[model samples]
Target: MLHRCNEQLQQFSHVNKKALDQYVNFTEQREELQKRQAELDAGDEKIKELISVLDQRKDESIERTFKGVARHFREVFSELVQGGHGHLVMMKKKDGEPADDDDEDGPREADMEGRVEKYIGVSFTGQGETQSMKQLSGGQKTVVALTLIFAIQRCDPAPFYLFDEIDAALDPQYRTAVGNMIRRLADTSNTQFITTTFRPELVKVADQIYGVTHKNRVSRVNVVSRDDALDFIEHDQSYNAE
Candidate 1:
């Protein structure tokens, strides 16, 4: 009985040692988990900060681009319409309506910062008219559209441009201005303009010209000289007059 009791006591001691080791291992794991949690929290905070800064920079870039394009639009419109004025408007909205900051439920500060960029819009006023684009005549709309295109191109120029019947709806005065502007751009900038027009204004300023002839079901395109292009324009004008 004495030997049996000693063996039982030894077994109990071994069990107690194992339990102690397990407790230590659990404690270490808890500490490691807590450290990792802290690191993850810090990383999350850093990511949020970076995102905030990126948003700010993006807003600033947008504001700058809008302002620049607006200024260019104003100048181009004046030139195209001859005494016309134009500008861009920032339409900040709250729930799809115009924002009013005085309201208690107005947009937050962050929303305001981004709203200008997100809701930037254009307001066009044609020659001797104090109306919006929707109220402008078809000819006026064409001129305004062209002005806007040129304004945007000034902000971000391309290597080449293709315009199809851009002067079709334009008045003679506006067409002349557009042709002059295209010539000026071609002379000053290292860009090419490919335009199709039945008016003599564009043909007169063109470096190269092409003529398209369609007979029955067959169509043919051929390069033509400046005088030939002008003759074609004259013939088209006469046909339209009849």
Candidate 2:
């Protein structure tokens, strides 16, 4: 009888232990579901906030784009009216930055004045050497003209460069220097150049040459090969011999 009672008590204890384990597991699963639902709600709120912020940003961006385009068109219109005679206009900075000044008009005026002075190498003071485009000699004026042209070209480079009698006023040495400079610029930028000249020395460095002349009141242009040019020079020398 005692052994039977002990076996029954052990079986009862085992069933109670299994039921307690099932209760604990059910409680844990319910807690985990609640935690997941709370997390999902938080995520939804965060996504809504982000969407609101993005909408605001999109509106701001569209406004900024339209303003930028309008400003660009205004600048283009101004340039067209000015006959494209000015240097490349860049934004002005006060104290080396855009925002260091309280006055709005100060920076623009300063930048325009600075650019004009720099382009002409002028001084605010009366003591400095004054050089004007009209007062310069032909060669000096050519140099100044070329300098201005180069400055403008640096701002906006073109596909082809045509130099018509640019070296007409230059001496032989200056002509060679200008030729070398052009060659260097062409080499670096891969720009095609067509220059008209009557000087053989200037034509010597050209890759291709076209001679333009008026014959019988008609203009004729002939593309002369390097060999033909040499032959022509030799034939002219022979004629000088006679």
Candidate 3:
């Protein structure tokens, strides 16, 4: 009877072991399914974010293209009119109304007009400045010209800037201000600038200097070494004093 009881106990122990193994397998399958569902959810969220980014980029591209075209038009008109006034206008539909006015039906014209109005600003200088252009001392006119040119440049920055005699008429203080402003613009826009001037003070700030003079009716250009250029200027001043 003791031997029989021992055999039954062994059988019961084997059955419990098999049942525990099945329970562990079911638990593993449930955890794997949960993990896979989380991965799917994460992938869906990433796709949604990518779509949103792409849509934002598309809208930005469209807006920039419109602004660029408007800028080109303004430049052309200003050039043609010799810096005279020009206007850019845009039309938009009233809120809660159809996109078209009495003149047209489609959305294209309204959209175009809206973009034009949205991006362009009317720019003008005082008549006093223009009228005094000639009578104003060279220094004053230089300031005015630089102000206008800088204002236009600030409106739409580019990769390069060319300035010829911009500070020739400025005083020492104004010249320093102009230089500082140039450096600021360079820092902000990654712009490279080349300016030509007869002023020694201005040339001191230049990265490179080219000296041009007419000799015997022929134009001669020399890349001036900084020290040599300074010595030459001193020699010329001494001779003038003598």
Candidate 4:
């Protein structure tokens, strides 16, 4: 009789707990859903505000850099091209980078569009009418690229710079211009410039030459005097001619 009574009470307890389980779980589930909705609002004003401030600073920086670069570019390009003149114009290419997401700029296209997308357009007379990089001859493009590089370095100079055959496209004239430039900068400027090149012209202007040679598998660096390097190059060229 006692066993039957205990079994009946256990069954009664199971049904009562099942009935309360839904109400107990519903309270926590609703709170979590509410929290998730708040997080997923898709409107992050603080992030947007931070982005706007950064964009404004970027525009100002680019504007100042463009002015400095354009002025220097005109002078150097002229020198490099042997009486050539060019212009550097900053214009919009496309929004440099889009908003954090499409939704971030929703309904604010006009404001955000103007904030991004500034690029420099290079045009030179006598380089044909195309005024495009692709249409430019190798030497012409090298002059433009090297001029801009020097211009930027002038604007914001650091201790040293590295170059790897930056004037490989140039002919003798432009190469000499580049050599003269290297000489001038090395003699006048406090900053050191390091470059690797096969051009004898460049080696002549270089203050130091670290000749890298790979033997078997290991590379060795030979520090050669400028006078010796020039003599070696002349001898090699003469031998090649013979």
TM-score for every candidate vs. truth? Answer: 0.74, 0.43, 0.41, 0.64
Which candidate comes out best when scored by lDDT?
A: 1
The total of clashing pairs for model 1 equals: 0
Candidate 4's residue-wise lDDT over 111-219, tens digit each?
3544645443444434323276777788778787888888887778778878888877889888888889878887778878787776688987776777677999999
lDDT of 3 by residue, 118-181 (tens): 3332222333222434565787556655655555565566778788878766787777767766
**Model 4 TM-score (2 dp):** 0.64
Model 1, span 38-86: residue lDDT tens: 9999999999888777776666666567667767887888888676676
- What's every prediction's RMSD, in angstroms? 6.2, 18.2, 15.8, 8.4
Judged by whole-model lDDT over C-alpha atoms, candidate 2 comes out at 0.56
Better of 3 and 4 by TM-score: 4
Once all C-alphas are superposed, what RMSD does model 3 give against the true structure? 15.8
Quote the lDDT for 80 in model 1: 80
Instruction: For candidate 2, write residues 1-242 as lDDT tens digits.
Output: 99999988987774565777899999999999999999999999999877766655554453343334333333332332233222212223333322221222212222222322122222111113333456657975665456445544544578888889888887766667667666766788777777876445557778777766698999998998877776675676588779
What global local distance difference test value does model 3 have?
0.58
Clashing pairs in 2: none
| Of candidates 3 and 1, the better by lDDT | 1
Given candidate 3, what's the lDDT at residue 221? Answer: 85
Predicted structure 1, TM vs. truth: 0.74
